[model samples]
Target: MKVHERLDQELSKQGKTQAALAEAVGVSSATVSQWRSGTKTPSATNLVKVAGFLGVQPSWLSYGELGGKTKTVDPKQRDAYRRECVWYHRPAPQDAGRELGNAAGFAFHGGLSTFGRETSQNILDEAQPGQPTVEARYTLIEISGSRLNSFLEAIKFDDLKPHLEAAADSRQKVAAVIRRGLSALADDGRLILLRVEDYGAKGLVGPEYDDGNYMAVVRNILDSFKGDNAGGSYGLGKSVMWACSQFGMVLINSTLSVAQDGKREGRYIGRLELPWHRLTAAEAGSPEAYAGPAWFGEKDEARGDVTRSYWGNEALALDTYLARDEDQPGTSFLIVGAYDPDERFQTIEDMHDELVRALAANFWPAMVERAGDDPGMMTALVRSERNGVTIKSDLVDPHSYTPAKARMLRMHRDDLTVDSLEQPGDVVRRRITLEVPKRLSDGAHGSQQHEAVLLVTEADEDDTDANRVAFLRGSHMVIREELVPGLRMGSRTFHAVVLAGLAAGGEPADKAADRFLRAAEPPEHDDWMVTPDVSSSYARGYGTALKNFRIEVRKAIREIVGRPTRDLSDGPDALKELLRINPPTVDTTKRPRVKSAVGKPDAEGRWSLDVRVSLPAREAPWRFSPVLRFGTDSGAAIPVVWEKLVPETRCTVTGDVVVAEAGAREVRFHGTSRADTHPVMASLATALVDVRVYKEASK
Candidate 1:
């Protein structure tokens, strides 16, 4: 039937005028007329209203009559809305190359919900770092905008506040706590905390800048380590922190360089200030070359607010700013006006650690001598709920000791050098070696250096041409076409250069090194049979220094904060109070001090403490074997190594291959050879096993 006829019939039956129907249906009469003429179709929702106005159910207006229910929504519409809701709740990418739609993915925000706030990253990334400003120092504009402000607010760090306070609070607190507990344990007089975690994605970084060049500046600084340009490279991990902050990052940078390096040598401490100012798009260049270094040609390094205490421009000479005076100099940062991190990164340690990790990747000690693994430096990363003022290494931190000697070491490179003890020019094939020593390693760990090398790799074994490996006390050993058998420090031997290479006395692992021992094959054109670079050697030295340093520092920190509890929530105030001490009463008669010692000091004459070590007595016999299996059936006739001697070793020991029968189970030992009785003799026990296994023949 024609829609007009049907509509006319309906209207006639209902006794309703066009205007009345239009009003009832909440639309113009023309719309109703068009629906009737079939020029346009009434929406399903509208049809239902029309049917109600016409005294009929919606189904009767179209297909058929309905008992009681209202017409259903469009299937396509229902599907679309359901899909839209799903999209709204979907998750974003977590890392790179992520895909959506499986379990979790894209989500839409409610127009008025807090989730509706734009989450676009505030890319502080400018093509050129400090493009708006000149030099490493930055002075940024006060960022403003709703979303921008939200991001800016997101950067606020309540956790960072305690850390900043601790960095500034009297070293007395630092010292007292360290002294009362472990500070005295440090050979030098300081402690450091390092935390490393990756920046999930590239993040904003650069110093403060009032100039419009924020974008360029950020890019330059963040990518500074790339060193692709003619300009000086900077570590933006620090700079960006300075930029977005109202108050500048604190500068506590200290150097352990002996006094000779001149201006950069020694310990120093001071505030790294960034006073705020306005900026424009044209200023990212050398200040002297472009704007003229002199401030208005009147004041030198004098910014308008130069005299303000909050400014970051105080320049203290190295010698005068450290140690005894208390405020040691080192790099510390506090950012202002930044996007707050997501809940996933709610703590200051998280934020700071993320920045550090970015630095770990960006600055990777590859450029520095003696780089260690992917982490680069063996830093002691710590997270503290204690008011930060009491932060000190636990006794087990990686960094616990001496700045030199017997330190935890990371091997970067090594070359097999055989200078025949008695002959000249008598050469041997060079072998490269990389070693991460379990003994010299200082850091407490998830996977500790307490064991020998965690891994090892040979050229042929690793197809990529890289020395890929992880080592443990008795892990599988990889041999190569170039290998020759020998003996080494308690382990199978190879060459000293190889050991040195891995031990910090050989070639240092630089940014480009690919092998564990920095055992790179020298370019064909080079003629030296084996040569280790000074850089590599220095790297070994550095690792040694770091290991020792960590040990020393950790020793001190542990002494400072002792006594672990079921509750790890001790506040910083507890540490401060622990460090406080009232002076002891004195008679003043004979110079109040310790009386003469009842016992003479040891030959070393220094305070010494007992050190303990636990050794495994019996390592379960582990054997790699050749197997023979019966096809289909579960039985096979084979030599039982447990009862028989190995063909080769048996000939060497007993001159025969005979042994006790398999079921007898009475033999003392068995192996590829009869001499295998001593197989469990761990080489490391050569010096110390006697101490643990036997009581000193009493009298």
Candidate 2:
């Protein structure tokens, strides 16, 4: 065999150097050089090693036939050698198209966006010149009855009782004992509640809906890092749910129907993941050594003891009581002792209200308007029973939620419309090409240059206005309403959405878009990553696109503001316009009365006075000035320290004072948005806290 020439050919094919191959084969460079130069032939053992390192059959390297057909060997040894030849030097499978580096492993099917840039480009090109005014209908989504279930006391123990008794072995007795022990526990004895916050407005639980890619997001992490077309590349988003639980864990319940053996079977899977600990360091083969992580459910004995479903497991009865008789397939998450890392909300109610309102702000368009090919008109219901009253907190249409927007909507709809929708005063949509930096050539998905679209709108007048645009890779919004360089449209607040098309020459645009989206976002999907200098081609591409978008926005703003406007201020019309611009404030004199008191014991034996504070949502981001005044039973003013309340949400706070006497403790939160000053100054709203102290604490 001309081994030297063959070695040279394989090296060239793999683009490997002699030194690299030598290191890989655990041989000296000189020996590899000599073998390649035909100066010497390796021994039989080394020859087999050489063939394996080159990912070729030893017989083929020794003789001249593929699959070692020309060589003779023992049948058993031949099969073993073939197996070795196939994988000994083979590298782990990888996607060359992805540039996510450490995040490359999360490119799974049904991940994020398949047609990111392509669809974005189509939308940009196909978007009509005018910004059409769309009408939206507002309604309430009431989620009554029990939306959750307790797993501790509710198990199919009767289904397993007969099996436990009929087991003609010790395994049966052990199973029966476990079942009896678990059955004796109360509902809260070992049970927890899981909250699954689905992305869109409509939670994943509806009759005509399918769980689709969301199921992958709930079930697995780092499983998506495979192909180029994955929707999400960073495996981090899946961990957000797990980390939300105080135990860094959660139990998942999903309904799935499968067809096996020509029979359609309905399956409800309850699964949980918990980290196992070892009491002490023991030898690897020890019977009770520490195991890292284990599934909490029934184990499949035939499959090397892999846990199946938690539902039929005797130790834990983890089936859902929330599943309906007319069952619509969806998912629920049970986070035992759920706690927020941000410390934004003190209780479950506060978190629910904050989340509902935040969702309304971020996805208002998707909820009110039809998002093409996506879930239509989303709704979320956060319901809980408190003090004999079932409180359901739901997101209403923006017109109903924000008072400022509600006022604007009340005006004649025709007056809000401009004669020409795409005219300067109406809206502007521009599709432009961006020049890429010259340094970004090798990593370029297409040519160094790419295309992007910019849209600017001057509709919707809310005083607490943020004029920012969203950066989109495809349909997936990379960055929410953010300001880019040169994007400041002064005085008049506006809304905008921008999209960038990215590409490198080797793959199709859609595939390139997948790589772009994967590399751009971190695992948590909070926002696009800000690590271009330290990241892969994907982040760098976004950086470049962002820079280009800023340039385009500056130009569009200049063109749009250059138009003339009609003067609507003449005598009586001027006064009316002034009143509309500077709205009146709510009268603080007629504040809500809080006469009830509720007290609970604190951990330190000190009585905790729970107060329900009512603060209405604001139309804009403004600081609230809260003034707390305390009065004694004899109508004497008592001094008290006012804690800074987070203006973002309404919450239940614990009052510090143990009032010996109480008449009225007033909290008036005032703001300047509704005032008639230049920057406006008026009392936006007030707050009332229901406090209960050890003594008389009612006001």
Among these predictions, the greatest lDDT belongs to 2
Alpha carbon deviation, residue 647, candidate 1 (Å) = 45
User: Model 1 misses residue 693 by how many Å?
Assistant: 9.4
Candidate lDDT values, in order? 0.24, 0.35
lDDT of 1 by residue, 262-341 (tens): 33222222222211111222432211111100010011134431211111212222111111111222222222322222
Candidate 2, position 426, lDDT: 35
Q: What TM-score does candidate 1 get on C-alpha atoms?
A: 0.24
What's each prediction's TM-score? 0.24, 0.44
After best superposition, candidate 1 residue 624: deviation in angstroms?
29
After superposition, the stretches of candidate 1 with alpha carbons farther than 4 Å from their true spots are: 1-329, 336-345, 348-396, 399-503, 506-686, 690-699
Error of 2 at 604 (Å): 70
